[model samples]
Target: MKRRDFLAGTAATGTVLASGLATQASAAEPLKVGFIYLGVPGDGGWTYEHEQARLKMVKHFGNKIETKVIQNVPEGADAERSITQLCLAGCKLIFTTSFGYMDPTINVAKKFPNVKFEMCTGYKDAPNVSNYGGRFYQGRAVIGNIAGHMTKTNKIGYIATFPIPEVVRGINSAFLYARKVNPKAEMKVVWVNTWFDPPKEADAAQALIDSGVDVLMQHTDSTAAMAKAKDAGILAFGQDSDMMQYAPKPRISSIMDNWAPYYIQRAQDVMDGKWTAKDSWLGIDTGIVQVGEISSAVPAAVKADAMALHDRIKAGTEHVFTGPLNKQDGSAWLKAGETASDGALLGMNFYVEGMTGKLPS
Candidate 1:
């Protein structure tokens, strides 16, 4: 063989090897994902549910992704700062798991066009920002059914986080079902205004108990209300995650929010370059909102009826906000056999008939 021919062949082989190494390096880089939480994972409610979903996603993706979490991030300026930090840190996708983070998510997303943002329990959306939440009203209806049947005082209490449409819709849905099962059932609401303040939640629970409330519901994210109910020897429903540890008594059935599937799908979409901004309000039909097991504390007939209602809703045969409903002022809201539209439910402000007290302006 000629010397020059051998040298040329060796050079070609070296170039090909280096190019192959470069390709492998590029392929080995993992997608970076971030999550912002309103409270600690140990909160045992809303944040716990999101944390569980995150863990599930981690297990599913394995080494294909890297995850970063910022917990207990306040909603306003702090949220914006945390999200921006994640974006600057090279996060290609971020999930802000709280309603209050909506504006901050949008604001951060505008500055990071290449990054995708998902806001939970929020309505706002942008080209890079998607919104999602569970149709918790459906689950709440089941809770109300249990409450209506289980309550000895006919009075139920609701610990509301905020006066937003989301909380209002849950209150109204629970009341509707409670009243349907027991005409004498009445709901009293106490707005704590904070999503995860244990002290405030406990105080609200005590106030409701003092007012003759025997069964309690909450839109806030905490186990404080459950503790209060247990101490008071009353009944309550769990929120976000199953509080079954307190079950068989104070904790009867529960409304569980399952966000694992959604999180995994959205992350997968990001990896596949198919992530798109959209609104998702999934419920029992999609397994996003689940009804926790009804304890033996409830009457067998009541448990059967509650499960039937759950099945009907899941089968789309029953709507939580059906017709034959009226506004708080006694004005007709829905005629018989009619159901509410998504738009109306999204923007719901006034209370339905039979509700007392003024909604915050």
Candidate 2:
């Protein structure tokens, strides 16, 4: 859900001085940074990627910064409490890493205006809060291209976490690019709703395989889908992070969400007292989102083709949501040669043509 508009003006220098927060400095005390997560750091996908970046931040800042993490914090009221506790624990900067934590992050930020809040996969921003996320759909297009060429059954399955626009966009991008290369390819979706349930994600993977799917993709934050595909003798792509450790067979490639560079920069910004609220949606060009290793299981030609598409997207010559596109209901959404606007894409709640299954309400 969208929240209040971002505060308009910059924080006056006098505001910081008047608050006396700018004077809190000590050579011995490290600037405290806090991170709140939707799942455990060992989930091996979304949360895992963010945790890796957190580790990177620690390495980059060394003794200059001290970090704290609270894991498995559910969205809504629970998140607000977790964030509040973090602020009370002497954390000067906090990062809430999940889309569902949007409202909670904003609400908590209000009570601690001097504390900086960074939210991942959210659209809202306040004077002390910033929104940042990667364009995951860009990487989806590349993996979908590989899935199109490698699938022997021509049926691709998508294991989804929720019906949010972020998830929907990935589904649409994969379907559009998959069908582009293999006209006979059809996408089948199974929504598990929850983001990091290993059992539920595994069940969904098996269900999709039972439905004759020989290639699998997932929006959930676990390697269960990849493991299931490996056991089923099918192909799959990793979500959020590389799963090539399970590769050479079922896991042919992956969509990697790289947060290290951005995380490091934001930490530096806070240290330099230059951090401000702004929305950041970066992708392959900025190394925020990337395509992971393509295993030897994929044919060389298909790998090359996928990389070419990835390059075009990175160069801005190709758009995943570009036109001659239509909604799932056969309604024209974009005319030929037209590209989707950021507003439309951010609020997308409908599926594109050729994708099967209803978007959850």
Candidate 3:
């Protein structure tokens, strides 16, 4: 969706960050930045968060920058065509915002070697391309702590979008935090398999609740999951963006993907002739991944505790994946004080101990 608030902001287009040369430490050059989105910008979740970052980049650079965005872009052939079109149209710094666009991004980047590429939420990194994302798992930790205290059944339901590491890691993060407060707490995940389908997501939420989950969560994009929770009078955490508005009656808190600042910073690096390929995986400390207002559905005292926990994470005094953990198979996954690393986090393939569900093939 087009954002009206971005009326005066600058946007990225074309190719690499200050890709034209940057032979001199300082050069006054205008840059065109290109952005690709997997869904309509107004889907109100995943795509919206990225657009916010685009608008901020616009505002940050002003006249020296221009942006070209192609929304509702599909992942396959359409992606190759879009990248070609943007490159032909003169985008020197291209940022493809979805994981599916990864190879198309590399394909185009190879053809337009002069252009720099940055793929959000993707793993492939070329000399001209880098990846960036946040520690969404950290937000999951905050929600898990609340779930442990709020659930009457000690059964927390998660409506997961995929078996990809991102979704799996979030499940583990929430489970990690919950077990600390309630040792018997268990997480049950229902994978909807797609990121943006509302009907399937709603069905997943209903199925979980039917199985006796008192608290719910989701990694899917639409508001259907929350709506389902509200209808059933179950508590649930929000996702991607602050989805509280959709299910005010049941929304307990939200894991917000705040992407604006990173966008601005990356684009500014281009403007200032300091752009380079680097992986930026930021978290609560950088104000990138955030959990918004613990709802009144959560008791005030518990809210205080959650915030305290949040602060500890921010200060690096606490890590969500610390040792002394177990997999769902009853095997030890971590020793106390032994935290899982980025490598393991990125390729997580198992469920933690106590989660009742099967991973989809």
Candidate 4:
């Protein structure tokens, strides 16, 4: 996935080139950027969104940047290998786009101090490494509201990808908002232990539908669940990008992860010699995570309510994990009118109140 080089244009011999322009062109060698993905680009979910952003970065920079990708890279030791290789291959800036890549990215950054690293959805940062992720829970809250109003059965199924804080936060946010709208709503979770397993996702969706789940949500990356929801005449929300093609009705709305702006900014930062290691968790306010269109199937009033909530979040007037929240144990988590802290949310381990089922070890 190397970025194509810029075409070598000829200089008019008679025209003396501007001093800074010539020097800038000569100094601006194509930056080698590397992207590491846990799943293939066609997963149609998380990795797909990341890849889209990478493409956007490429397009924005054109020949000023040369980006390479190592997809289907497993987390753990394998991730270390990919990061090391990318750094060795002259990738000055590398993005490891997976939670599991945290430790590996940090380790590799130590080995290559000059190489800048970005880890997506992970909480590790160093002088050469930074962390960035979308506040996906914000989007989940909107979908949860939709599910509460739309579900024929109060049993909503959530296909979880892993037990990490990111995934758990999404699940809790969905349940919290859904319960607020429909007090009787219940969330059933099925952990697939993988990010983009289509077969497993389909099986989980089938199980949920068979068990009378009228609405489904997933942290897994695939359209299989949406397809299953369509077949079962149930409602579902798109996880990362829009998956409406497979099941238009079932896929009522989606959480679009908009990574282009951030990607462009970071690449431009490098170009301007202003890149730095920092953690960013942007949501509707910054267009990092957006609420997809609410289908006509959703009642006009309910849709309006959801959109209002979306707008409120975008305007920074509301918080997803607001006051009157509790832990799975019924213990006080957030006091009335209190909001959750980013630190607590980032290290979230327990499920919030109103959601049953033990978190897997």
Q: Estimate each model's TM-score.
A: 0.92, 0.92, 0.89, 0.93
Candidate 2 lDDT tens digits, 1-361: 0000111111233244324543453444788999998898788888998899888667655566799999999988999999999999999999999998999999989999999999998998699999998999999999999999988889999998788999999999998899999999999899887988888899999999999999999998899888889899999988888887888888888888778778877876887779999999898888888898888998899999999999999999999898898899999999999999988989999999887778897
Model 4: which ten-residue window has the lowest total lDDT? Answer: 1-10
Best lDDT goes to which candidate? 1
How accurate locally is residue 277 in candidate 1, as Cα lDDT from 0 to 100? Answer: 92
Tens-digit lDDT track for model 4 on 4-62? 12111112211233233456745778889999998887888888989998887776555
Clashes of 3: 27
Q: Rank the candidates by TM-score, best first.
A: 4, 1, 2, 3
Cand. 4 TM to true fold = 0.93
Worst 10 residues of 2 by lDDT: 1-10
lDDT of each: 0.88, 0.86, 0.82, 0.85
Report lDDT (Cα) of residue 333, candidate 1. 96
lDDT of 1 by residue, 278-345 (tens): 99989898777888988888889999999999999999999999999999999999999999999899
The lDDT-based order of candidates, best leading, equals 1, 2, 4, 3
Best by TM-score: 4
Backbone clashes in candidate 4 total 0
